[model samples]
Target chain A: MTATMPQAAVGASLSPAAVARIRADFPILQERPHGKPLIFLDSAASSQKPVQVIEAMDDYYRRYHANIHRGIYHISELATEAYEEARSAIARFIGSPCSAECIFVRNATEGINLVAYSWGRSNVRAGDVILLTEMEHHSNLVPWQMLAQEKGARLRFVPVTADGRLDMNRLDTLLDGARLFAFTAVSNTLGTINPVRELCLRARAAGAVSVVDACQAVPRMPVDVTQWQCDFAAFSSHKMLGPTGIGVLWGRKDLLDAMPPFLTGGGMINVVRYDRTTFADVPARFEAGTPAIAEAVGLGAAVAYLTAVGMERVARYEHELAALALEKLRGIGQVVVYGPGIEHRTGVISITVGDIHAHDLASILDREGICVRAGHHCNQPLMEKLGVPATTRASFYLYNTPDEIDALIAGLEKAKRIFKLT
Target chain B: MRPADDLSGMDELYRDFILDHYRNPRNAGTLEAPDASCEDLNPLCGDRIRMDVKLHDGIIEDIRFQGRGCAISQASASLLTETVKGKTVAEVAALGKDDVLANLGIPISAARLKCALLGLSVLKRALKL
Candidate 1:
């Protein structure tokens, strides 16, 4: 019943039965691309929604569709309660100390920008250093670059190793005198799971604030902000089987209270009198007019579904899947997979077959109804470091199966034959 | 499972000649002290091309391309070199995306249009057209 068992006995943990049960909740799994069964392997980009998440949003819009906070009518009150309840659920899901510390934005990109513009503008002075990693997705890299450029601050990076993991040997030197140490808990391009707790502690020891881009980590594994001891963390709902346009920014209560408001507008103010106005509380002050109401409900349902499934099981299942994929890819002889070995990575596999370009490989895979992302994956700097124009990435989620991995292998074989690589 | 006919598009795209062009590009190097040279990148996919051309009497006397990318991009660059060799810069300027598509002789999806058009864009830039 565990992933440690042989392949025949391993399906018990997120087993075929469990995966099939989970797959049934997703209606999009029934889709056929090019008259072939859809094998979704791009969950790292955006995960598909389950019926629970979809229904929650639908039911909210159908029954209690009203603006929150201001309306006191029956349906409005219900809508407000649903929105607040979603916030509380998300706060609890990430193990934040309090619900008020969770701020809802459009997505994880906005979450990072919120901290960069609000907390960064205040804390980061001229000549201050902002430390990052070479493996950062542009979402996690660009905001800080912009902030550093505008604030006259310098930016330093922890280089990625040959195997694509962060080079931690240089951490002390990089964190020295750094004002903020912002890094991804799991690299979107490399799939390397960083030691978030250790990195946070090191940043604290260096007298620097820590920010975590948990977009990939929060979906695949359990994330407890309180345990990480990081000042701020950001993650998106769409990558966790919820609707798009809603994400969470979890920060320390004192930090959230002290930071200036990111966007000033209606629903985020306390006293507005044609002149200047005082802002509302932490979460509200960050969330501007007309937040994603039904999207919050969908995210709440997603968290509930994940809670029911248990994140430890998801993490273990994905680890097993990644190990199986790496083994199979190694057997192919021509396939080169990126990132660290199975022990330090997730189910995201970026690969190159012989000299076949990623786009060409993805095109052939599409003919087989296989969905894989082929590009820099929004990590052009990392792509440069890896010395490849592009890579074809196959990322697994709870619904993916070993059969799908076999299909991907078969598709790659077809691509090789087309290119005459063999 | 689907019928084999549904997947014929891949064959058309990776046709033997296209693959031949990609594997063994016609003119795949940089020109030394070239009359005109330009480099461009498909930022979305990170495909890059640096084109160097030698011009004589307003004609592209010699041209070569050096870069790395997908089969479509490299093949298109190879095919473009053959198409514009010994042609007047004005004639190459008149060449459009349709001409490149006709040379490629395959249907390209909207998503892959950038990949297919990258060579021509770089060629135009090299000629300063």
Candidate 2:
């Protein structure tokens, strides 16, 4: 059944069945925590793996464990075939025109750096502008800052409204004489699902290349690179119930073929000598050194599992869960929810209690076996702009139930009672 | 909110003295004195502080600070101001690393030790020592 119904009802009816089935699918979620079932609400940071993804990796390692490519051995041939199969799976997931355009890296940060150091450094001339948003994680912002510094290009920010959504007019203003525009499709801290298609259309009109950081978005919603028509996109596997140390960067094949390699190493080369070396084709030119083979396989399995459940269902369920969380936290009255209330937010909810340190509140929650992240969330500039030292963030995923949201409410009540915040 | 009973060992770090200072910080705002000011940050961890020291007769007449950071860093700033307020420049310069470490009485991981010691590092940088 479609999970678009109100969350409280889902908890009472639909979620119990869903949870039973889903919990069985995820072995780790069944573990006891102080005699209580584990409540994982930090999926925005990293998601727990399902058996499908785990078994896929196990099957690869056990059956076809060998160095991929450059070997005529049977295991190597099998390993190479499996590795390329995973690449094709990822390209299909993201709707890339060709599997050759996808480059594998350590994580989303490295993917962004690849674009910044190579594409940005090469294309961006002095006095040209690179547009970004104040809401960006450092991964998307810092590399551009360094590129601007090195290339003598201007790094400009598209102003975010007081309510945390992007100001399209300000983005238009910032795009003047711009070489490229890079922004997050979903803010890690604010939980704003950016209008990426609209932004990309505008960026194209401005003659600026558009790069979407889909690290938070790809896992939560359907991301079709062909439909969005972004020049480049990056996302991490760990954030989507796959293993860490594997990330995907999908760019238009033409753009990727034209750009130079960010790293120089063994696997990414076509030919090398003492004097000069030639790089491989589009994707291999970017993928340097030994790649995370098992992790990529796991990510392929994750893609297959997500496809089975369907992304629209995941999105619908997450939206309901987030609204429930927002309603419950707002009911407390002392907590201030950041971002566009709860209605327009992604699965993340960042909050602060009146006169209580975010870190202290998080520590209190941790004592009750309810884990949440507290700090600037690696966005110090955003924290400064928001005029808060830190915030406590609770993020949800497909596996999270509305019962867990109630449990969170209970935990917060205990925290309030202990801290006398009420 | 205070830590749990199982976190008793952390009491040395989150002592009443430190928590009291954190809750009700002393000289927390910028100093209006004619002394020089220095702003420093541990960029790796995003810890920052601005120290305002008022000097008279080569001795610190008043020391105030203003900034945002974690408990360990902020509490250490409070303790540093208390220790160096009336001390001479030469004496403050002579302050040992052990003295700074003793003031922050917690077992700090190597990565976090640098974050905890940031205030002292800034103080030394200010002293040109």
Candidate 3:
């Protein structure tokens, strides 16, 4: 199963029984829309949750539903324990040395904003340059733009090659006067798995703090912050098969402790008088107000499930899926697949056919109960760089199968016929 | 390809006339130094349209729209241009979203309602209606 197989027979290469067991864990797979079986290929937008993650959240709400901390009651103590345990679970999941470095925010957008407002506002000075890449999602791009405008800092872009990869030729000049470097661990559209450790080290050597937007990377692959030595990383729980409303922001404890808190409230403070307030330590200082209790518990369960399945196996499975998809997609005439070679990519596929609008293609797929994302995918700059109005994207996860890829090919053929494209 | 899953259902939404309008949009350019022009972008889906109108004696003497988006948006803009040509400012102002949908001859989903009406939105903004 390690070696790539032809697209038509890739399904049987892996252990079918094991893949079936994994697929059975997710209840949403049984859903039939328009009296047809669902073939979800839009995991990049948000992944479907498994029963284990669902049960964990349900159990939390059914029993031990209480405000965490500041309660002498038994349920409160249990709730607090569960929340803190989830934090530790996530920290261990990402291979962070300490749990205190993990702070729960709303989503990846908020996680980036937290660093932009707190760490960025304090450290970024006038005339400083913040280097970013062209393929960044709006979440990672906009916050830095705002920070640059507010702090009178300059912004530079690292252009992506036509083959949908970072241009490594001009890295030295891009790093030259950059105060901070923010980049994605894995491009959501192109599925470019970046060299996180090397990029982080380069930024560190240049006296710049690196922020890794791992919203697409953490679930699909293993991420070790200690090895990467990046200053900060952000990811969303929902995108990784956990419930929405919970995201993680991991930073070096020293950087987090020194930076000002993002939001001010009762829970995040240590001493609050009428005059001024002192914040709590690392994680607590950033986690203001009552957080998403059940969502955190669900995310903890998701991490546990992934750990049990093993990230390496998950990554391998996704690679197979991606390779097969690329082969099949390329075989279809006039279908241009956007991204690196399958060897350097994940299961995310962005493609376009001759004169067929992305939205129209998505609609046609939806009619066949195949789910795919259309439009700019929150990467308008990337769309501009690619010279396409929009692209139809189909992303995969562990629960996906080769049969679904076949259905996608069939669907595209049908769309081509309908549009008189062939 | 199976005939049962043919584009008959899609034809209900994207009629031939709509596709024709999208393929050959009328007035798909800028009215130079127009009396009014406004660009409206749908933040959620990223569909954008800018309507430029040249007014004379409180009447739209010429109008054009420019932007790239989905078929529905571009076709709707083309259809809007066809519907409002030579009409008085008050007459165009009195027209509403229902008029465009009626002329489109399709049932629009809630998610695509924005795309269908994006042209109208830009026109309304351009005329301050």
Model 2 chain A weakest 10-residue run by lDDT: A5-14
Please, what are the lDDT tens digits per residue for candidate 1 over residues B1-129?
444354457978898999999899999999989999999999878888999999999999999998889999999999999999999999999999899999999888888888888999998988889
Which window of 10 residues has the lowest lDDT sum in candidate 1 chain B?
Answer: B1-10
lDDT of model 1 at residue A201?
Answer: 96
Predictions' DockQ, in order: 0.61, 0.20, 0.52
Compose the digit string of candidate 3's lDDT tens values, residues A29-80. 9999776799999999999999999999999999999999898999999999
- State the lDDT of candidate 2 residue by residue for A111-145, as single tens digits: 99999989987898899999999999999999999
RMSD versus native structure for model 3: 2.4
Top model number, DockQ: 1
DockQ of 1: 0.61
lDDT of 1 by residue, A1-422 (tens): 24343342244258688988999999999999998999999999999999999999999989989999889799999999999999999888889879999999999999999999999999999999999989888999999999999999999999999988888899999999999999999988778999999999999999999999999999999889989999999999999999999999999999999999999899999999988999999889999899999999999999999999988788878877887777778878589898997778888999989999999999899989999999999998888778888899999999999889999988887787777777
DockQ metric, candidate 2: 0.20
Give residue A114's lDDT in candidate 3 (0 to 100). 99
TM-score of chain A of 2: 0.95
